[model samples]
Target: MDKNTIIGILLIGAVIIGFSIYNQPSEEQIKAQQELLAKQEADKKKAVEQQKAAQKKQEEIKKQTLEDTTALFHQALTGSAENIVLKNDKLELTINSKGGTVTKAVIKDYKSLDGAKDVTLFDEKDQSLSFKIDGKEQNINTEELFFSASEKTDSTVTLTATAGAGKTLTMRYLLGKDYMLHFSLQAQGMEGVFSSKTNAVNVEWNERCRQQEKGFTFENRYATLTYKEKDGGTDYLSETSEKIDERISETLDWIAFKNQFFSAMMIAKNDFAPNASLTSIPQQKESGYLKEYKARVETFFDPTGKTPTELEFFFGPNDFRLLQAMEKESKFGKDLKMERLVYLGWPLFRIINRWFTLYVFDWLTNLGLNMGIVLILITLLLKAITYPLVKKSYMSSAKMRVLKPKLDEATKQYDKPEDQMQKQQAMMQMYAQYGVSPLSGCLPMVIQMPIWIAMFNFVPNAIQLRGESFLWIEDLSTYDPIAEWGTNIWMIGDHLSLTCILFCGANLLYSWMTMRQQRDQMVGAQAQQMKMMQWMMFLMPLMFFFIFNDYSAGLNFYYFVSLFFSAAIMWALRKTTNDEKLLKALEARYQENKNNPKKVGGLAARLEAMQKQQQEMQRKREELERKRKGV
Candidate 1:
């Protein structure tokens, strides 16, 4: 029985085994599946190999491009550099073959700051002018390459260079009798050498301005980078900031490196490219360098290399007259307006200096008078011009002096804060009745301040007075040091200037005279305040002595003469004016004002309105206070 059961179970198990085996995949199908998997693996391997081949080809192209660029750069830099010199009546320039740029510029008529030798604005190591050309196959900098010089002359020179692949660049320079040097840059036969899409060439100009003045701090204060936009006005970087980095998106007309009394300018006859940049970094205090200036500009360039650009270089003193004449005589049909480099205050003060002070100074110098004498005469002339204003101011002060007793009586009624508004109204009424304006004296003084400030700016920057000598002073443009301690102090330098001391003395005397007159006119608290301010005025001269000790001797001398003239004129005014007559006139005017009861206008009307507003506010404040106190 066990055999029969086992056989049946075995038969069922065999049938199940056979069915499972039949349902499984055949060998041909398995082989086909395996072949498909293998084909996919082969396709992925082929794709990876193709990708690697593409990357290798790209790397080879990059390497070839780098080698081509290096070869081109080497070709451009193969020649030896040479230098050519050109001289004119005012300037001497050395042109370098490397970049066909000015390597050195010397002023023939000027001496160094120490009076040891001729002044050199820049040297080979301190300046560079370079061009960057972006071509289809190569990019190169001209500054690192060399050029061949040809057609050399005493006042002109031409340089030619190759940019590989039938491209040529030429730079020509011509020096005139004046401070101007004409420069031209031309590109020839560069059809496929540069990128045809862009129409601009990049230029870089850098200069380290050496100190050529007696005062480095003063010179550095004036050292700045100035630029004029094409069809726009002139602008400048901040001179007082530590570093300046500016970008101009508009076209530029010119760029300049302006020192205190001199400048080096580059003028573009056409216009620069639409984008440019300028940077400046001040050197160390004792580095003998005023500033480091850099300009990155773009100029119009044709890929066809047909047209050329004309430019100009001006290396000279910052003489206002010369610059003005140059502006008038410009051949580019644009006013360069280089005279703006002169630091003679803003427009109003500059107009005064240009129209009055400089003309007078020139006239006086033409008379063969020494600069000191010219300064004195100019001071006297200016005093005469302002004598009317001074007299009016003094007369106003005297009239107020005559009315002081009445003003004091009025002020006594304003002893408490509650009476402040009423007291102010009463004082204003009295002033209106007497026709005495408290600001009249100050107004006249304010009108004369611009002239004084203009002169102060003009004298220090006047190149005409640079080497002019006067009594006890060898150079008027620098401090006349009577003694030098060889140590720097706060505000005061190591040297003591005689002209500065004299200026301080004159200022002190003028201050004393003015203070005495003002003090005699005031009483009580005002007199006390005047006395304190008189001491402060005396201290002002001492403070100025320290400040001016290192300043220009011509400026100090001019100030001294101006102060002396002011004191003398004031003394004469006091002697000629009769106080009793002034008092009587003031009383008569007051009586007439009371009788006529004239309608107030101008400042009096404004003051009355303000007083009314203030009195109303005070009344409201008192009413509120009473309500709060329930009184």
Candidate 2:
């Protein structure tokens, strides 16, 4: 039995034993367990309170650390041996010989579109902000900020921010308002420079790529994302950049720039230098986002007699409508369109996912008797639509199976790798005579990848399945629900996911059946191909087990159903095909045609010639070796 099969059996055994124990739980057992827990809690409460008080004191001490950071800023900005704070907001930032440039810069309350209205100090929605020191007061300008609103749109919200000097930077939450929150940063000051840093932002995503790593990198015309957070575990992602966007001018416009998902950066012409590459700058891990960004920007421009260079900022979700209205790379909204499988196989898959989900899903959701079934119906419909392709693949596999014996004989005759070329030439002639194309089966399977990806993305965030339950599963929208175990463990969660287990079993069965059929036909390079496939059979299911563990149970259920259907189809094919008769017929035909004196030889004649050549080569090579050794 395969390792997976053994593991599967063990898992089943464990579940059965656990179930039996759970059902037989006695009142005395429950009472004893409860008493032990109550005593432990009673003994720990006093020490826990004391520890809590100590933690509170430590938190206060940590809060004071922010002021020390603020002091460092003052010392650098003053350009004085002894740093003196002119006022509370003005702090000196030290950048080495180049003068410590802005370490970080961002607008906090202007964090999201909802928070944009609170950014009142800036005028246009895409407004540019820059600060400079003129004697005692800081010279600030929002003209380059480019704050804007639609000609007449009710989704309008008020934006306010502290400006001038000694003003508290504050923004209030706005209710029942719609606005595009836009933010851009100034990090060119750090470019052509090296430092360790981190950047954090609060952003929400409806659907995200699961495989992206924390340090994922993308480079293109507009900007370069040196790295991105793989698992968006934390609220924000930080990146380091070698180049920065040079266009710091104040002309409000949107253009293509490179981003993690799309290609482009949305910005105005006057806010940054022309042709200057835009890049994400990192900050210290311990630094506060809003406070650090402000301090860094202040420090960035301290050199040119405190010349203030304007900066633009955006804060909001990549809603297509909002992105388009903002005119800052509106394509960020393109995400609302299903796009993962746009280029491969058939573009129709993308169109279907984008259109069907938007139009049909919501309407059909009302009739839901467990969204898992709805998902299955959707998959079945898709399969029906693409039935021709899948049928072609099955037929090809059947044809390959019929030709397996002839292919195997060809390999046996040409045992040496160096003789493979001649062996292939002969094998090709046989295939040509039989009118079989070796690639026919693989082509259709390759074509199905895109449709698979489109479905993978579609199922997870499909709101229809959120609270729905299927048989034995409580929630199709989340993972298969199971009560936790008493023994605590880390990383891996306590409850076992039944859907994931079923999904794996189905995958194993499908893989085993497919592999068994291919094993007989494997030859030379194809044998190596079979080995790789076996590895995939083992690895792929385990990969899905971890990945789908947290995904919608409905998605896993869909996969299980698909695999089961495939297994059934394979069984039907095997039962109907007369393999024994087919093999006998092929062998009889080969024997009858072995010495027909045909030109260029057939598969059987080629095998005879190869075997004779193999014997002669072996004899000659052995004789030559003996002579050289003076034997």
Candidate 3:
């Protein structure tokens, strides 16, 4: 039994060993495994070598690029910048190659504030323009890099600069016969030079506006920032504010720094980026500068440097007709609506000025009449147009005057406070009987107030009146100084205007004449109050004399002429009106109203309703008093 068991065990063990040997890997398989391990080691070493070589190559490339940039910047900074001059009939521009900026601009047809020299809109010390461009590894400011200038003519110039290898930046300017100048900026082969992170080119423009007019305060009031949005309306900064900082969220068409009579405007062809910003700061009175303006704008710049940007600049006077023609002609390929820069007034007054006053003034100007005479004619036309209202106002006053005697008699019959309501009722009845309304005179004057305010705003801002001479005045736009006190005074300026004096004198005379008529009509405390008010009215003209002493001579003259005309018209009306006849007619009207009370529903019905309301209110008050007194 042991032998058989042992043999079986040995056989099983040999079979198991043979199976294990058969399942074991062959020599070829072992050789293949070793070869694969060797190949993997070799491949890992090759990969490391490749990485090192690539890193070294990249370092070399970066070093070379840094060197090239340094050399280019050195060249740009070392060279002496040149300048090119361009001129036209209206302007002279001096362009510098350093920043490719307009260093100086002279207006040919304008004079300095003192009128002693030709006007310079801006000089090198007053302006700065720069462009910030994103570079591959750094940012570049064009203002610090010198540019090479070529292709200069009487009205055109070109400036160019090399940004990097196969890359260039260029600027061109073309002056026109008028007050406009065309500008263009271009970049070429800048795919590798500029960064791909953004698609905007940042621009900065700074300017300190110079004073070009005789009056600083007057001109400063008109200085402001005006901008037009693309596909939208125009807007402006607050002219009366001290400082302004505006961030535009809409695409912009143009930007302007407008002074009183002149402006410097920049127009973009393709529109500015939506995130542009503008700032304005007014200079102090002692600074001699009109204002300080700063603009930070972004424009589209092709990352691949294929497209160019075009712009236009206007440096000229703020003439209404000229701006209108520019808008009509579409000089910028779109209506710029530049005429809106003129501060005519609000919508209603603006319409009046645009459709009526401006046209009439132009017509008179075309006739070669003096500005003073033109204003006189305008006043006469206005008076003629409003004559009917004036006549009605006078007739109402006359009717009121006719009823004064009867009103006094009625009022004298009631001397107690309890009878005050009854006395007022009687007076109202008398007025109704005479067919007179207290509001009639006041309403006509209220209707004419807009015209007066329009004229007040228009005359001071009229560019046509500037430097115009008439009579003893040399400039109708400024105070016609007849005397100088040699010292500045509050409210009253150092100089006294003859036109202001004449205006105040005429106003006082008008007030006296009107107060005389009112004194004759009023009685008791009313008369006393009116007498005090008449003195106050005289003081009003004196106050006006102080306030308007520094105002425009044309405005003062217009007011004086208007008051003169009013006094004359009022005097003539007083002379023609017959008091006795008016009283008789009022009596007849009273009888007729009594006979047909239902048909007299105009003023009498309103008075009757008012009387009833007063009586009811008095009754309620008396009832409340009785309840409180337990009577």
Candidate 4:
């Protein structure tokens, strides 16, 4: 799209967004409103009232079990179960089933997937599991059952544990169940293993039961198969599977399933709550934006016992090609597609990265050149390609700068708020006579935002940058190391990351330079707008500190390099574009147009007319504002 069209669209979008946000209800108010509606419905209908009572009773029972299970899981978080044996593999930490259902699976080895010693994998008190397996041991707790597995197989590993009334719990992984990864969970009375269909996986109880209500509840959000059985009754709850794709299938294995994908560590502290999935897309938090754009998979289990839960997990890359091979979600690979905007210059960037990874990084594997340096090279290349456009923008800004003194005079003359509209129109006429476009300078910068966002997503997730070192930073995939005095301090974490700090400083410097130039050339509300821009720019890096602290150092490195390069380019432009020459040229053009009216005919005159119309609109708006304020 053209610059004018893009800017117009952006302005309209901004207005619509502002109106929407202003009209939207707050969280607490929405909750209260829903509660009131529920109450009103209950008061009107007897059936509604009865349903509410039943729901409340079920909620209380569920809450009690959740709390109890969570507590028990917390106790077992640090300790290992008796019937489980833990073994470490290159890819995964395998928990072998000796003879027990996992009361809790606390995979502590993956605390820091980025390979940090201090970062804890699981919250010791919140994430835990409770379950009974078919095992010889009556009461087994796998305190030391933390393992990793390398191979990708659907081998049936038998698990045995104790249940309520002291019943035997037997569950096994069913091999050749599915092409991707499969878990065939079978209990005493349960028949056949549950498998995912096109949209869902049905968890049926016994042989002949077709009723959905009989110990069954399907959860579209979680993609889980749940079955609840008491002496008198049986119940079931099934959750819809989470997003999955090719990358996930490619990297799918035992280790990552437990570590990165599965929050089994949460089970250590007895936190068995499933990760939020994209069931209600619109109502979902913006935090899930990336998740929806990318790929995710998670699993939850409940083995009926004093503590009934043996959780299995799967987390890894979203490999679209690999997912296409899997039958579960034929759409998994289909949905994990990148947008056109996302692919802007992406092909080039990927090619460059691949070359570096395959050729450069390989040759110099040990002596890691700083990622910061790599970023500088990339910035230099980008700047070279964009130099022509950058120069044009700079020239436009320079022309505007020359006209500023005249604009200031016009502003002062029509200083009254009541005459603001007249003043703005007069200023536009002045610009027309001088041949200047105020917004031309902002077009290039505005167009670069999408590219910036694309890069932001790329560098953080890039496997090439992970574990690679640059200067004092040990891991390019994580925060820079520094001397730590304490732990968990706000912005100043234990040890401040060097790249993030540098990025913030660079941002402040860039903002200061740009603001200084604008302030020198602006007046009235325009000057105030410049000040606001300055404040926003200054606050941006600080705002990102928390969010980006854990991000790949390569991203921070890229920002720092890009800022420095842009500033350098700006400085060069200022030096090359002579103010005197530009003023003389503008004056010469104005004189030529005035003397030879034909020189300003056709399209130029039409543009001048449109500019005049826009200025008139601006004046009218200002007049309305003044009348509303009674100025």
Candidate 5:
């Protein structure tokens, strides 16, 4: 072997020896590894045994739980349910033995939207209510259990659920002569049957509200789930396809499933717990229902049966004046604010109706005139009160109309775009000379807008107009179908309304007259803008015909009558106005303005400042152009 090969072999052997020494395990490490493997095997076996034992324990617990729940309430769980009737002057209630629930409610001597049948506010298929008892052995579900009912009186009943060892839960109901039903629940010989940790019981209320009116769209828009929180303002679920409210962090005094014209309200004297949930789900139009409303709430419970939970159920029409009188006469309803269920509108319009229109309407109704005549009188009264403002607005427009010749001559003088600033300046000067304020015409109309919108909210919600008919109208609260095809169509609905057509016709005539008066005043770009506005205004009445076809006859009648009165007033003012005399007065005022320039003030002053600024800017632009061209 060569010398280099021999050295390389020795080096390789030494490196292998060093690596073996570095990685070699000690006796202590080998012992520890074996112990670890043994411990792992032992742990695996212990886990398998524990899992099997836990499963067996769970099975035993479930069997015991079943026995605890079902053994005592055997009779209560197996029987068929029976129903009993409770009648009064204003309401009839059907009580079921199964859940101790009010299965149905009918309003006495009242007709629903159909105008033919007595109003059935709710039936067994539409609503159900139940209580879940929190007990010691098990959380008892009372909904599926039966109770033995006893007749206490003509308007009162007692339903009792008895278990083994003579323990019992009893529910009692008393129907008042009015629309309210008093309810209470108590326990007897059930000392150890309730859990100590739970202080309240759960209440389940589910309602698929039935359609109460022919106009589903109108009825659904006004219906919602309304509630009043203790020491807080009244609130409600949003009117939409689906909504849920689970954030009620305060005790509540009452909750209501409010329909458009009626409601089924539950008022708790002791108040409900802070934890509650409310849900709203809309139903299909073909289902003959408005929406589905559900509420899961909690109420205070007494384990010892010392005091019973007390509540009152109100079933009646949403009459504003009646509810107001009831509130004044109630012991617990002082703070209830139940009349809010009859919505007026948002704050501004509501104020108008609440403070003015309601009082006038009630007075007119008390006068014993026909409803149609009452509406006409109200329209005439409103027109008379607002005559001064209307006269001033028309006179302003007429002043501009009389100056058309002077305006046309100025238009010819400043026809080019470059003279636009001069034209505006000249127009402002002419308006000042004629002593006219353009916005004077609009401010008065603006002041009258709240009244118009307030009436729109008032007419539909007026319960007094429900069945009152006049002049071939069967019901004023719903649409009067002068022409109905018995088929649903987009935008036009299933009917053509007579009042709606009349209102649109009056509106079109008014629009044409107003446009003719204003068109002569506009020139240049403003004239083009006026033409576009004219088209929009003319189209509005046509669109309103389609939109308002399904609206209540009362609302359409109000609009039609109001428009007819307005057009007549305008014609009267125009006939009384003398254009020649008005023009001579304006000429004299112009000569006076020429002599006394000190009359420049108010909006005219502002316009003068703006006109000067425009002229200065135009002069500077011209000078700049000249400089750029080296002029």
Candidate 6:
């Protein structure tokens, strides 16, 4: 071997030795690494232990919950419920031992649309009442528990639910001789059982309003939840809205689940607490249900089982007189005003029906008149009451018709667009001089509109005509379907109503005749406008046919007969009266009152003032334009 190669090998060995010494870990570093490895192993072991402990704790909690739930409510968890019935002259109630509530309500005096069966207000599945008992272990509802029913008395029954060790909840029902069902609840030895701080129980009533009438669309429009606040006016949730949730922030006295002609109402003997929630959810029309109504109210109970929370139920036909005679049966000791459920109309129309139409119809019916004859008599009575105004209206229109030649001559004098206000003013002046107000014809009709609308409202809700048949009509209180199909149609239902068609025809004929009387009296743009209105008026009846196709047969019949007779009367007057005599009388009166200031003091004066103001402004604008043009 060469000496250089040997030296290179020694140097390489030395370099390797030095690098090993420089990169080697110290004793402290090795000790730290050992400690870190031991810590990681300990942490892994701790995590495993914690996971096992948490799982065991969760299992213990679940087991405790199950045991607690089984302790107080074990016997009530499963059982067959008993039904006890209480009947009266007007109502029949079935109370179930499951929830100790009325499971079924039947109005005994009314029949269903099927005609043979009685009207069942609600069945077991349609309605359920539950009482809530908050437990320290588990929240509980009494609707799931089985109750022990006591033997029935003449008018009362008591249902009791025993929790254990003498803890009991009792519900008692006393049937009134009429449509009211009295209910009360009391608790015994439930100090530690009920976790309620206020010692009040929640009373939840859920009800699905089923179709009661033959016309589901029409009847469903009237089915809703109506309530009255304590010391306040009556109110209702939207009948048309699909879903509505309302928390009555104030206390309530009564809540009514009102169908078209029937109602199931609950009245609080004291007052239901604030925050009572009223919910309305619309069900499918084909489901044979109209709406699902729910009311959640809190009422206090006596923990010692002495004083009971009292409530009353009203289940019957919504007969206005009968309901008006019901007891002042609520919290504020005010009249129940249960008659409001039989909705007549809004304020003015309602007043007319309540005061006049109702009494007259009752009197006529009591006198053994048929319902159709009664409606005819009502129409005749109203016409007779306003005969003088009708005569005056016709005479005013005749006066305008007779003076058409002179008004046309005046129109010829002012034929430009700029002369419109002047022409209108001149026409008004002529009307004043002739003692013929253009509004004279309309004023009487306007005054009589309330009575007309009152009858419109009165006939549909007139329960006296429910089953009364006249000619081809089977039921006056529902649509008289002359033709029916199996499937439903949009905007038009499954059937066509005969009375509704007749009513539309009468309306169209009457409108055409009335327009022909006045159409010739207008000229120029006014004539064009009247011609447009004639078409609109003709279409109004067609639109009404769609809107009122499902209205009560009695209402349509009344309108048809009323409008037909009105047209006949107008035609008779047209034939029997002499236009020459009316013109002569107007001419004589014009001569006598042409200068009388008193004759022009009221509406005519105000109209003249407005026209003059408008004319004066028009003149100013014209003068300004002329100056701007340097003319």
What would the TM-scores of all predictions be? 0.82, 0.45, 0.83, 0.51, 0.83, 0.85
Winner on TM-score (3 vs 6): 6
Residue pairs clashing in model 3 are: none
lDDT of each: 0.80, 0.43, 0.80, 0.45, 0.82, 0.81
**Pick by lDDT: which candidate is best?**
5
**Of models 5 and 6, which has the larger TM-score?**
6
At residue 451, candidate 1 shows an lDDT of 75
Q: Pick the candidate with the highest TM-score.
A: 6
For 131-204, candidate 6 gives per-residue lDDT tens digits of 87556655557776788888687579988777777777788888877887878888788667655464677889
| Model 1, C-alpha of 534: deviation from truth (Å) | 4.3
Once fitted onto the true fold, the runs of candidate 4 whose alpha carbons sit more than 4 angstroms away are: 1-374, 406-416, 523-552, 595-631
Worst 10 residues of 1 by lDDT: 69-78
Off by over 4 Å in 3: 1-74, 116-118, 230-233, 248-251, 328-332, 603-608, 621-631
Give Cα distance to truth, residue 447, candidate 3, Å: 3.3
Clashes of each: 0, 73, 0, 71, 0, 0
Clashes of 3: 0
Q: What's the residue-level lDDT of 562 in candidate 4? A: 80
Candidate 5 lDDT, 1-631, residue by residue in tens: 4455569879999999999998898899989999999998899899889999966774564456446765656567667798888888788899999988899999877787567557899999999999888776556667867899997666999999876667888899988767778899887777688867766778899998888888787778778998998987788887766885555777898899988888998888778888789898888877888889998998877878888877788888888887775555444654888788788888999998888888989999999988888888989999888988899888888888888778778776888878878888888777877787766657545856787799888998888887889798777888888888877899998888888898899989978877877886676666766876676799999999988888888888988888888888888888999999999998898888788978756565568678989789989999999999999
